[model samples]
Target: AQSVTQPDIHITVSEGASLELRCNYSYGATPYLFWYVQSPGQGLQLLLKYFSGDTLVQSIKGFEAEFKRSQSSFNLRKPSVHWSDAAEYFCAVGGDGNNRLAFGKGNQVVVIP
Candidate 1:
């Protein structure tokens, strides 16, 4: 079975400061990792994903993630976080051929001025 773990449950970052969220997975084969962000009353929005090819992947809103197979980690980062970036971020792992995914508990980000 595949599972995702986000060590940090809550994170505080100052506006315009860099932010990074850690995600670690447990799976037998190569896994598909994803980062999703959800605002206060909004649904989960895809931030970035890693399937294959490149180790570093970028997505909308200046968010990027790197897939480190050697460490079984896929961490998400933003060079400069905005106030709008405050949300709950989730890390998910899929690609088991069953189209199922295991998600982490999530990290709640609080952006302060």
Candidate 2:
């Protein structure tokens, strides 16, 4: 069985501060990892993905993630978080190119001025 778990349901951070979101997974084989950001009442945008090769992958909007095979984790990190970055983040695992994705509940991020 493959599953994604986001331990933090919500996170609050001051604007312009660094941010990190944790993601852990359980899969029988190598899984396709992805991080998506969803604004309020909008569709998800792909933050990054880890298929193979490089363990460290960069995404748009200055977001980056590193795949740690030993830990079965792919954590997201941002050097500086902006007010606009305050949105729901979801971790997903793609299964067998079926176009079906299993997503974590999501982590609500709050940015304080």
Q: What is the TM-score of each candidate against the true structure?
A: 0.97, 0.94
- Candidate 2 matches the true fold with a TM-score of 0.94
User: Per-residue lDDT of 1-113 in model 2, one digit per residue for the tens?
Assistant: 67899988999999999999999988777789999999999999888998899999998799999999899898999999999999999999876654677788888999999
Candidate 1 ranges beyond 4 A from true positions: none
Q: Put down candidate 1 lDDT per residue, 16-97, tens digits, no spaces.
A: 9999999999999989999998999899988898989999999868999999999999999999999999999999999858
Q: Please give the CA lDDT of all the candidate structures.
A: 0.94, 0.90
Weakest lDDT window of 10 consecutive positions for candidate 1: 93-102
Clashing pairs in 2: none
Segments of candidate 2 deviating more than 4 angstroms = 97-99
Compute the lDDT of residue 52 as modeled in candidate 2.
90
